[model samples]
Target: MNYLNKLERKIGKYAIPNLSLWLVVTYALGYLMMYMTPGIISYLMLEPAMVLRGQVWRLVTWVLIPPSTGNIFFYIIMIMLYYSLGTALERTWGTFRFNVYIFGGMIFTVIGAFVAYGFLSVTGGLTIGIGYYVTTYYINMAIFLAFAVCFPNMQILLWFIIPVRMKWMAYVYAALTIYDFVTTGAVGRISIAAALLNFLIFYLSTRNYQRVSPKEVHRKYVFKTQMRDAEMRHSGGVTKHKCAVCGRTEKDDPTLEFRFCSKCDGNYEYCQDHLFTHEHIKRS
Candidate 1:
C-alpha cells in the first residue's frame, strides 16, 4: 500500500476522473451498436490471433463489447449497479487508485488472453474459439466484489422486497465464480484467473480484514445510531449544526463554530478545530 501510495503521488496527476461514467457510457453505446448490427461485435472481440494477423484494433476495441445482453430491465440494472459501485470506489480510493485498479485488471486480462493463445498455439495451430473465453464479464464481477468488500454492511432491497446485505450476495457471487472455474475447461479457468488476478492482488495488498468483520461493522453501526439518536433527542428532533468529524452538536459545544467544507464532495460540517485540519473528501 505504501508503494502504491508513492506511485500515486508520482502519476496521480494523469488520472481520469469519472472514468466509470465513461465506461458505462461505452457499454451502453456498444449495446446500441450490437442491437443495430449484431455482426459488429465480431470485429471487437479480444482475439490475439486476429491481432497477430494485423487486426491490431482488437486489443482495445474489445472493451466495447458489452458483457451480456438480454432483457432490457436487467441490462439497465446491471449498468446502474456497476456505475454506482465504480463511482463509490472512485470516491473512496481517489481517482488515481481507482484508475490503476481498473486498468491493471484490463492489462492482466490481456495477458491472460495472450497466455492462453501461446498455450494453444504451441499444442495446436491457433484455434478460432479462444477469444470467446475472454470478455468483460469477470472484470465487472471483480468491481462488484471489491465494492462488496469495502461496503459489506450496505443493504440492497432484493426484488424490491427482501433486504439483503452486500457481503452475503458477494459470498454467493464468489461461490458461483468458484463453481464455474472448477467445472469449466482450461481455457475458461485461465480466463477467470487472468480476470481475477488483479482483484486478488489488489485486495490482498490493501484489505484490513479485521475492520470488515461482522462484529466491527455492527459496533460501528450501533455507536453511530446511538449517537444520532442522542443528538436528535437533545435537540428535540430538530438537530442542526452537527460536526461531521466528531458528531458533536452545537449543544455539546456551544462556543465551537461550525462551517461547511467547500472542498468536500458532499455537505460536511466541521467543528472549529477540525475545520482547518480535517482531510478534504472529494467525490469523482
Candidate 2:
C-alpha cells in the first residue's frame, strides 16, 4: 500500500470504496493467476471468447488484469506504475468522478460487446469484443492523460533511464493506442472507442464550457475581488451566492451558478462550478 492509500485509510473510509484501489487489486489478482499458470491464455490475457461467454464479469473485471508480466523487473515496474496512477486519479477526481470515469468505461465496454454480439448475430462474423481489455486499458490511459493534461509537469522514471513529462507521455500513449486500433482488430477497436469517449467526456467538463452573461461574469469577478479586499479589512464583502452543497464562491464562475436549491426550493448558495462538477442530481 502507498502512503496515500494508508493516509486515506487512516483519515477516512472514503478511499477504500474508491474504484482505483479495487481496480489495482483486481489487476494484481489477474497477474498472479497468469504467473502461477504459464500455458493458458485466458481473460487474464484479455481473450475475447471468455468475455463473450457470459463471463460478463470480465466486462468490469478485465480492467484489473495486469499487463503481461513477462519478467520480474517488468512486473514490479508495472505494478508500481499502475498503483501510482490509481492513487493519483482517486485523489484528483475524488471518489465520485473517478467512479464515473471507470464505470463509464465499463458501460462502454459492455455496450461494445453487445454491439459486437449484434454484428456476429447478423453477419456471423468472427467473434469480437470477448474481453474488455482494450476498454479498461484505454479508460485507465484516458484518466492518466486527463491528470497529465491538468498537471503537465508531473513526472515519472521511464524504464529507469530517463525522466519524462506526463503530457508528452500521454500523447505517446494515445498514439500507441491509435496504432493498435489501426493494426489490431475487433477488441482493440472497441477499446479505442471507449478511451476516446472518456476523453470526450473529460474535455467537455471544464469551467471553460460554462455559458453565462458577461455582466454576470463581471459581477462575479468584482464580487470575489471585493470579498478579498473586505477580508483584508475584517469585514464582510458584498453579497455573493454560495453553494450550500459545495462551498464554491460564485464570485468567478458566474455562469451556471446555483441558487435557491431547486429541490429544497429555498435557501441555496451553490455556484455553477459545483453543480455540473458534482453528482448532485440523482438519476431517478
Candidate 3:
C-alpha cells in the first residue's frame, strides 16, 4: 500500500475520473447496438485467430460484448448493479487504483485469449477456439468480487427481501465461477483464469485475508460499536466527571471521588485510586 501511495503521487494526475460511469455508458451502447442489429456481436468478439489474420480491432471491440442476453428489465438491473459496484470501488480506491484493476483485467483477458489460440494451434484439437468465451462477462464479475472483498460487511437486499452480506455473495460467486470453469473445456478455464487474475492479485495486495474472516470481522465490529457507544454516552452528558487514568466516570462508580490536581500544569483530574499515585501532568 505504501508503494501504491508513492505511485499514485507520481501518476495519479493522469487517471480518468468517473471512468466507471463511462464504462456503463459504453455497455448501454453495446446493448442498444445488439438490440438493433442482431448478430453484430460476431465481429466484436475477442478472437485471437482473427486478430492474427489482421482483424486487430477485435482486441478493443470485444469489450462491447454484453455480458448477458436477457431482456431489457434484466439488462437495466445488471447495469445498475455494476454501475453501483464500479463507482463505489472508484470512490474507495481512487481513480488510479480502480483504473489499474479494470484495465489490468482486460489486458490479462487479451493475453489469455492469445495463449488459448497458441495452445489450440499446437494441439490441433481447437476445443472451443476462444471465440466468445473471452468476453467482458468474467471481467465484470471480477469487479463485483473485488467489491465484496473490499466491503465484506456490507449488506445487500436479495430479491428486495432477504438481506445478504457481500462476503457471502462473494463466496457464492466464487463457487459458481469455479464450477463453470470445471464443467467447460480448457478454453473456458484459461479465460476464467485470465479474467479473474486481476482480482486475485489485488486481493493479495491488500494482505487482508485474515481480516475478512467471520470471527475477525465480528470482533472488529464489536470493538467499534463499543467505542461508538461510549462516545455517545459521554457526549450525552451522562457522566459529568471522569477519571483521566482509568477513563471511567461518575456513572461507573458513583462512590468514587474525583478532584483536579493543584500541582499539575493543566486541569488534570483523577479518581481516588490514581489521584495520589499518578504522575503530574506537565506542559512540554
Clashes of each: 0, 8, 0
**Which one wins on TM-score?**
1
- Ten consecutive residues with minimal summed lDDT in candidate 1? 122-131
Residues 1-284, candidate 3, lDDT per residue (tens digit)? Answer: 78778988999899888888888888888888888997888888888888888999999988887788788888888888998999999999999999888999999999999888888889896634487788788988999999998899999998779999999999999999989999998888999999999999988887857878999999999999999999997789656688889988888878989999898998878999999999888888
Model 1 stretches with alpha carbons more than 4 Å out: 207-284
Best by lDDT: 1
lDDT score of model 3?
0.88
- RMSD of candidate 1 to the truth, in angstroms, is 21.2
User: What digit string (tens of lDDT, one per residue) describes model 2 on residues 1-284?
Assistant: 25434654565444345566677677677667766775433544344466556665555555555655568777776666766786777787676556656666667766766565565667777665355345355666776777787778988778777999988898898788778878976655765785567666666665462437687788889999999987967844544566766665645455644655455444554665555454455345
Predictions in order: lDDT: 0.89, 0.64, 0.88
Model 2, residue 195: distance off in Å is 4.2
Angstrom error at residue 37, model 1: 0.8
lDDT of 1 by residue, 1-284 (tens): 88888998898899999989988988899899999999988898888889899999988988887778888798888888899999999999899999988898889989898888888888885556677888888989999889998999999988789999999999999999999999997778989999999899987987578788999999999999999989878868455788888988878878889999998999999999899999999876
Predicted structure 2: lDDT? 0.64
Candidate 2's C-alpha runs over 4 A off are 1-18, 38-57, 132-135, 207-284
Candidate 2 at 128: error in angstroms?
Answer: 6.0
Q: Which stretches of candidate 3 lie over 4 Å from their true place?
A: 127-129, 208-284
